[model samples]
Target chain A: MSVIEIKNLTRDYGGKGVFDLTLSVESGETFGFLGPNGAGKTTAIRHLTGFLKPQKGSCAVNGLDCWAESPKIHGSLGYLPGEIAFFDDMTGLDFLNFIAEYRRVKDKTRMRSLLERFELDARGKIKKMSKGMKQKVGITAAFMHDPAALILDEPTSGLDPLMQSRFIELILEENKRGKTILMSSHMFEEVERTCRRVAIIKNGRLATVDSIDKLKAAQVKKYVITLENEKAALAFAKEFAEEDVSETRVTVSIAGNIRELISQMNKYPVAGISMPGQSLEEIFMQYYGGNKNV
Target chain B: MFNATLFKSGIKGGIKTLALFCAVLTMYYLIIVQMFDPALGKMVQELAAAMPELMAIFGMNLNSATLTGFLASYLYGFIIIMFPMIFSILSVNRLIVRHVDGGSLVFLVAAPIKRRDVAFTQMTVILSGLLALTLYVSVLGIVASEISFPGELETGKFILLNLGALALHMFIAGICFLSACIFNETKYSVGIGAGIPVLGFIIQMLSNSGEKLEGFKYATFFSLFSTDGLIAMRPNAVWGMVALFFCAIALFISAIAVFTKKDLHI
Candidate 1:
């Protein structure tokens, strides 16, 4: 069952286009939306959450159109916006209480547990909270309803490594409870560690959607080979058409055929061999085409 | 239920607002007490006689131009325009600006609720807050008037007249709230919201002193609850003011419509 179905969505604001895009997430599946900064990740999430209306085409959550049936669809989904903004005047506890009222749910025990898990101070005013703390509040609010599906945009933003790890743990726990999750992040490891499938969005368009295993298998492989002797380097070059051929070491880029290439390369007296896995930044460049730091 | 929720928050916001208003008024009162000079009194008497029409525009009785009347004159002008403008701005800010600035609008909009429900709730808060503040000022203005000028005027009618004036301010405040919905940016919303009331004040000035612009009162919020019209017991002007109040309500509803359908992200 499709938890979310976005068909040719295009949203633009102030001349910055969140262009024609199409994607889907299946029920009980953890899908990763991979993109660099300003790659329309947040815009796409906003449209899904009904905070925005598509400039063209349709988007739905569980067959309910986002624009037409936001109220109903929203009830079945948990959403965490990219930038968490809170009412400063309200205490954290009061804010969550108000949110509970808005979500039409009461689970004080669960709410408390979430606060404790996030290590959040419920007594402090939201204005006084650190950025990471505010993000925790946003995360807690999204999960408090225990909705069937969670749409998280930059969910790990502003969290320290420990908290990020804890968040990953929580997400896995939620997934185990049969909750469908679509998490957008620039962190490859975060998605690689948690998501079964990943959707790479570039220029507000779907670049690729494949299982993590398949993505890893299809991922570009970079290998540096150092020749034992100058004679072996020439033979190695002759054996295979190489790239970035340097003085002692030569770096080669290969795709899914790295194993075959490596077997062929072993024909030469290779002094050193190293294969580096693709980073999130490398994959983002392969899809988005711009200068971005992971 | 919406009303109940609105009333609670609106009252909370309103109380904070009323405190600010009272503090300013108290400071003005003390200044007036300190500045009550005989030369200033005579000057005010001459000025009042010379401009009976202007006195009415400032919510002062032209017939009574003594020291007390002179002082009340300043207080009346302050409360009728400046004080109310500030009140309207802050109250509107409390509804829309506060939410946008605090990022609470994000949380509110994220819920499985109609956008109209969220906007209407804020509208309810604005209306309730304005009403409470108007009532408080009405009572306070009357008591202060009585203490300043013992046995000189009909304090209740004056209070009622002040209530009518405050009602007009509230009407504009309501428009300010609606304007907040029309504009997405908080600064723009607050600017236009605050600007419209000030424009109304300028129009009130034009209506009074600008002989060619006296007819502009029809557009200014000041004419909606003309204290002079109320004092002279002009039912037509009062009813016209009532019509303007209804117009504000229409604007308020339009705001709800726009907000519900329009895409909002903050």
Candidate 2:
């Protein structure tokens, strides 16, 4: 059964909000929501978290209406907002304690473990902490209760590379625990590493929703080859029908099996072969029709 | 529904401001009660005769020789109304508008608590703060009066006067709370929350300035709690308290309703 469901959700703020959006995440599945700024990713997540009321349709979590039964639904839901804001007057530990008290979390074992894993010194005042430290506090608050479902928006925005990797490991560990998770991010590699399925939203509409494997399969991979000489480069470019040929380098785009390219490259005296990393942005650009606004 | 944790935190947030207001009120009460004298009453009346407009603008009527009437004219005229109104405006804005505008309210609503419960808890905090301020002033008034001039203070009428002031402050708090709930931005909340009551005070002052503007008294809610009438045991004073109490109850209810159903951009 789907643990989270948004059906025909519509909230229009002068053409900036989500419109007739529908999506669902089944129990124990890790879903990725990919979009640029002003793409209504936060809007849809807010509806699921019950912070927004749908203008025309409805949303629900765990078989309960997101708007009408938000309090009941919140029992099993954990949400990390994109823009982190905490009580500046409180220390990190004091803020965590306050949330724990209201959530009725009697056992502090999980909270302590999360703080240790994040390497966050929570005794310091929140206002005195850096942006990355504040993000860590927000992450701990969302997961301290060990909810069945988690919704995180731009969860790793302020973290360093080391902390971002730690967050990915944490998400993977939670997924293994059969937790339903939906995360939104601009970092394609992060989504590619963690999510099974990804949904792309553009201009308040769903662009596409498919498995990560299928999207990768459809992505065009570009390879730049540095030959020994310009004569050899021309030959290779002609052989592959490549137009982006320079003095001693030829760039080839391969969409199908690489076996043919391997055999073809073996025939040439290739000095160096470097394959540029293929990002989801290029794939999104395909859908965006080369629009640079993304 | 109520959340004790939220309430405690809210009280912690506003206690300093409440204490500041209480300290100021205490100083004022001490000075006013100690300044009371039968001879001073005649002196004030003579001064009023000389500058009738200035005395009338402040709503000070020191013609009566009794302590209750003297306190009524001096304290209730402006000090009591302005202090509690300022307290309510600041408290109500901090309780609801600050949280919502700053986006910290998402933490509370994201928990297993309903939006209605959150709004109700904040409303409770504002009311509790106001009650504490009123109670402190009431106790100080009685103690200061009894300590200096024993049995000369009119205990019954003084209690009634404080009760009337409390009702008026509650009504003022209701206005502030309603504005806080209706607006999502701090500027709008503070503008409307502080604007209405200050405007009412101005109107009340204008009405008291002269006989030609006496009809302006009915335009502002401040005119409902008439200090002189309450001291004289007038029926209108009791009715005014009742009206203010009901209006407060109605405004608070509507605020909760509006908050529960409104879309929070936070």
Candidate 3:
């Protein structure tokens, strides 16, 4: 059974809100919501958290309505908002304790473990903390209750690389404990690492939903080849109809025919070859760009 | 529905402001009580007669023959009403509008507490603060009157005056809370929340300035309190207090309803 569900949800704010949005996350599965800023990622997530009342359809969690039964739904759900705004007057520890008190969490064991794992010194005032430190506090607050389901919006946005990896490790650990997780982010690498299935949204509409492996399989691979001379590079560029050629370097994109590229490259003298990491931006441009129908 | 954690935090946030207002009230009430001599009352009445227009504008038209009348004329007219109105505006805005505008309210609403419960807790905070302020002033008035003039103060009439003032300020707080709940921006909340009461006070002052401007009294809710009438035990004074009390409850109930159903962009 799905742990979280949003069906035909529509809240039109003039021209900028989600319309007919539908998605579901099964129990114990890590689902990714991928979108650029202002693509209604937060809007859809707000509905699931019951911060928004759906104008048309419905949002439900654990077989209860998100809007009407929000308090009940919140009993088993943990959320980290996209924008982390804390009570600036209180220390991070005080803020966490306040949330714990409201959540009726008697066991401080999980809270202490999360604080230790994140290496967060929660003594400083939240307003005085750096963005990364505030993000760490937000992460701890979200995970302290050990909820059955987690909804994280751009969870690792303000973290350093070390903390980002630590957050990824935490998510993986939570996933191992059979927790249902729905994480929304525009960072392709993090989503690639954590989510098994991803749904891409564009202009408040669902563009595509597929497994990460399939998307990776269909990724366009770009290879930059440096030949012995400019003449060889020009020859290779002409042969492959490649436009990104400069001096003795020629860049070519291969969709799936790597053997054809290898056979074609054997005819030229290759001085050096390098492949850049594939980004989601290139994938979007190749597949979902310019075609609104998709 | 109530959330104790939220209520505690709300009280903690507004306690300092409440304390400051209480201290100010205590000083003003004590000093005013001390100045209640028969000779001084005659001299002040002569001065008020010479500048009747100015004195009337400040609601100083009461007969200052007794301690109750003296306190009612000097304190209840402008100081008590205006100070408590200012306190209601500032604290109500802080309790609800500041949290909603600054986005800290998301943390509270995202908990297991219902939206109505959050609004109710904030409303309770504002009411409790107002009650504490009113109670302090009442106790201070009786104690200062007893200490200064030993049984000269009419305790029953004084208590009635304070009850009327409390009812009036509760109505004022309802306006502020309603504004806070309706608007998501702090500027709008403060604008409408503070604007209505301050504007009413000005209108009431205008109407009190002269007989030609008497019709302007109908334009402001401040005219309903009628401090002199309540001190003299008029029947209409009791009815006005009842009306103000019911209106306050209705506004508060509507505020919670609006907050529960509204879509929070935070």
- Indicate which candidate wins on TM-score: 3
The total of clashing pairs for model 3 equals 0
TM-score of each: 0.83, 0.91, 0.93
Identify the candidate with maximal DockQ.
3
Q: What is the per-candidate TM-score for chain B?
A: 0.78, 0.96, 0.97
Alpha-carbon DockQ of candidate 1: 0.51
The residue-by-residue lDDT of candidate 1 on B1-266, one tens digit each, is: 25344346556657876777777766765565455554565666677678867765665555234444444456655464677667778877877777765556777777777777888887777676566666766565555555655554566556556656656766787778777878878778888878887887877765776457767857765666655555555786578567767877887888788777777765
lDDT of each model, Cα atoms only? Answer: 0.74, 0.88, 0.88
Best-to-worst ranking by TM-score: 3, 2, 1
lDDT of 2 by residue, B1-266 (tens): 89999999999988999999999999999999999986777888888889887887877876346888888888888999899998898888777887789988889899899888898899899899888988888889889989998987888899898889989999999999999999999889889988999998998888888888889889998878988888778999889988999999999999999999988877
Q: Predictions ranked by lDDT, top down?
A: 3, 2, 1
RMSD of 1: 5.3
Segments of candidate 2 deviating more than 4 angstroms: A221-281, A287-294
lDDT of 1 by residue, A1-294 (tens): 999888898887665656778889998889999987777888888888887888898889999998888888878788888887776788888888878876778767778889999889888888788889889989989998888999999899999999999999999999899989999998677798899999887666777787888666545667888988877776676656764677767777765666776686668777888866566768655443321322
Q: Cα deviation of A176 in candidate 2 (Å)?
A: 0.3
Where does candidate 3 clash, by residue pair?
none
Model 3, C-alpha of A208: deviation from truth (Å): 1.1
lDDT of 2 by residue, A120-171 (tens): 9999999899999999999999999999999999999999999999999999
